[model samples]
Target: MKKSFNGNNVEICAPAGSWESLSAAIRASADSVYFGVEKLNMRARASENFTAGDMAKISRICRKSGVKPYLALNTIIYDSDIPEMKRICDSAKSAGISAIIASDIAAIEYASSINMPVHLSVQANVSNIEAVRFFAKFADVIILARELSLGQISGIVRAIEKEKIIGPSGKPVRIELFAHGALCVSISGKCYMSLAAYDTSANRGDCYQPCRRRYIVKDEETGFEMAIDNQYVMSPKDLCTIRILDKILDAGVSVLKIEGRGRAPDYVSSVTGAYKKAAGLWNKGRFSISAAKKLEVGLESVFNRGFWHGGYYLGDKAGEWSGISGSAATLKKIHIGEILNYFHKAGIAEINLSAGGLETGDEILITGHTTGARKMKIGSLRIEGKSAVRALKGQVATFPTDFKTRKNDKVYLLVPSS
Candidate 1:
């Protein structure tokens, strides 16, 4: 998908929190990022929220990286707090913010007071043709609610095109969509189920993910109980439509969003890398991207709950499931040193991991983070720079195998689940 937005380039907009995640998003080729500050973002409970000052620094980083930085001012505010809210928005505006998300009607007024561009958040739940048209009246862009089908999105686009809603510069409003990550069980993300039950609010950026928690349903007739949470009845696995990203770009969707506010840095890197490659391969009419092997290989080491679906890209049949419990296993343990110059070279044949859990010798795959594949075997063994009888953890060992591994290739010791 082309990252061109109108006359400008369109790029992936990934979620970021800490410096590591921000760096990862940029390294993976994301064009922009959205995150919460200490007060306004939805993930307040997350460890890596930007302070008021931190956000200014982050703005600098974004400019240096040539990426845009957008702030989420999405929480509902009362009438009494407009003054303080204006101050925050003004500070963000001074930092060269691309946009600020607003859910309340007053958000438009507040944004105009500070002369900041406003994007209507999906929390507004502007469904149907008329609702989208209404939202476009105030927003420079709109993040469409995630419940729409491709046909529905097409319809929404037609509505906007017909109305000619003003864009950031009064050209035409941009329409962004969520292409990847966890989906809300609720339609408009207005569920009070979490706040009412756990005292945590999904609004104002502090969702405790009570959906991931277990629950018991009461039976009115028999008064019996039914387990809910562990079964993951409400918690759907993350949505990953990276393979069909082109279909979305063609839809004229302004931004391809990845949903992960509290995710690991490496996770951001892997997911961003996959989408980056896919988007690059996407041409307006010519389709010659055959990097299926590359995409699969790249996704192996990233943290995922398993079960990647086409999401709304193939229509609503793409209902998501719960995330896998063992997504952290992607990082494997491998032999310490398989090659003397593995760090410098690329295409090495076979590489050997430490014999920690191996019986005598076992065939394995050497998956490099950036280098792709370097499969090899183990015959001779050296521990602490000397020939060793067996491999053990905490022992320095060098065994010859296949792939020319460099310092960049993280060696994961593979052991499949039983």
Candidate 2:
């Protein structure tokens, strides 16, 4: 959708893992991002979740780039987990997070009292106008549940606009949705499979995701058995709204989200990049969602369960999760090096190599938190106070660092450049 839906603004929020994916989100087109820490995140165990220290740094990077960072407090809070959720909200405020995605009412209440903006998380199951408005009384935005239809969202967005209670300064409390990524066939993210099968509670941020596992329904009648398909009975295909970006963007909503904080770096990078490009075009008034077919390849480069569907955008269809799953993906770029400094004066990419690695004329690539990369040959690289003619064994010598890389970044070097 164009930045305007009949003159209204549209924004996009993506998922992030480490500083790399967070920066990638900004570089790509994410108007904002949502990530989780170990406490209240469902995917805390799956993705490279962020730490408090990392948020202190990454939040600054996001602010500088005009990209918002959201702290996910979306997990259902059991009786014992309330204190931890409080800590998460308090810490997020200290780190300057743009907002917090909340599901529990107490979590919402606590977050509302804080200075930060509250985006009602999907776990709240806020699918209607009144529910959205009720949360709007506290939340700055309402994230629709994954099980919502297009019609349901459209109605809620209209109600949100009707509310006179504006945001901190005088803006209407906006609406948000899960425009993409894996879907759970559970109710409002309250899955019992984890608790029932493995005694793991999804609300406690310890889900085993038994729903994604394969299952066979056997007939109880005289022990009759029938095998229809493979596992992943409840594993719905990922939500790919790239095809329906315009509808989502123009839905009078403030942010369209891609759901994957616990995903891999490749997934975070590629999916975030594709949506970033799309949103960039939309913001620039060159509206194109479906027209950006060329960008779709980036999404496939990462780990996906295949079977793309607009879920709820199209009429009801079966096998959303009944398809045979795809295989794992192995992408280039493994974690190999670290950033020492950025010698912008010499315009060289300075990086520190571990072990007896650097050889004369070897090329290394340096990627910064905010910068993609800067490539230069080892033949022309330099070490501290002297040319790195041969980087010594077990010593940390600075190599051509022209990419303006800062310390504390995970630099990746593609050896032999395959």
Candidate 3:
């Protein structure tokens, strides 16, 4: 972990939408993880949310791994939804969750009444010092608005220290920033395009993502139609700050949050590992341009809408839009098979190949609720107790592995994207 200019250890906060993503984040060295449950979070419709019964298990796993767990209850609340919202907050507190990330005043006040810590969500659009001072009454940490410049963030940080503003924790309020992942074109993600187009409210966590599609302009009188060539005009490029991480830390930001609760396990692993490694290098004074560039390439192997430094962070007034429709990842995974059994003592795994064949030296990935995301190269292969160079479909192959894998874990082969 790197230390910020204010002498606080910079934290890497990762997103987890499922057990697989949570496990991957822990293994990849994330200091804290945030997740959604029971359709009360901003990513509710985009992710496979956990149930109330899974709270204890999630807390236990995070505690055993020395990672803090945060439950997100940031969605807009209706009068009818208050009962369920309170139930979730009470459950999180009883289960030993570190904090609740919230936006609505109702959720914030409810959590505070139960003595549970709170971190203000980005949906609050806290941009200036006065907003920080106001929200400091309820939240110990406030994720600043994504559209602020570095100078604005630094000013707010300085104000917190000078005014001696403290939260319910009796400590000065800390500032968190979004260091990577999807960039919403709307102001602090308060968008109505999804609701207006698909009748799904983004504030209620059910956005249809209509902004990522292509569009054209039509003239009413002339009957002319012109397509926006080769660009998704409403979609902004994903934020990537590995190269400028030191600058962000120098700005006195405490937490670097990655925004991807809807992503896959491999995406969670790759992004978390990349940021962790870059932070370590920055702490050691080894985060050179070449090293940062290499890390960015590793990030490109996973899900992304292309990379760009956030416009406002760099003092730019215009947005950098994505040229393509979907992810621009350099590599994609193909389903190969599933695990049949694991020989723990022999350090071997027996796999039932249902699709693509596996060859020696081939790169493979295994993902499951327990196994997480494990990537390794095949050293040798054996089919039906006979030595072989390759294993084809419908055959059971045994391969040596240093890590434990569970039965029914999905296996995949890595291939270059077209």
Top TM-score: which candidate number? 3
- 1 or 2, which is superior by TM-score? 2
Tell me the TM-score of model 2. Answer: 0.78
Per-residue accuracy of model 2 over 135-156 as CA lDDT, tens digit each = 6677777777766667667766
Off by over 4 Å in 3: none
Q: Estimate each model's TM-score.
A: 0.75, 0.78, 0.97
Candidate with top lDDT is: 3
* Candidate 1: tens digits of C-alpha lDDT, residues 228-266: 545656766667776666667767677777887787666
Error of 2 at 394 (Å): 15
lDDT order, best first, reads: 3, 2, 1
How far residue 411's Cα lies from its native spot in candidate 3, in Å, is 0.6
lDDT of all the models against the reference?
Answer: 0.66, 0.68, 0.90
Clashing pairs in 3: none
Q: Per-residue lDDT of 1-418 in model 3, one digit per residue for the tens?
A: 4577456677899999999999989999899999999888999899889998899999999999999999999988999999999999999999999999999999999999999999999999998998998899899999998888889988888888888888999988989999999988799858999999999989989999888988788899998998766558889899888888877777889899998999999999999999988888887777777898888887999999898865578778646889888789998899999999999999999999998799999998999988888899999999888888999988889999989999999999988898
Q: Is 1 or 3 the stronger prediction by TM-score?
A: 3
Error of 3 at 399 (Å): 1.1
Q: Give the lDDT of residue 288 in candidate 1.
A: 39
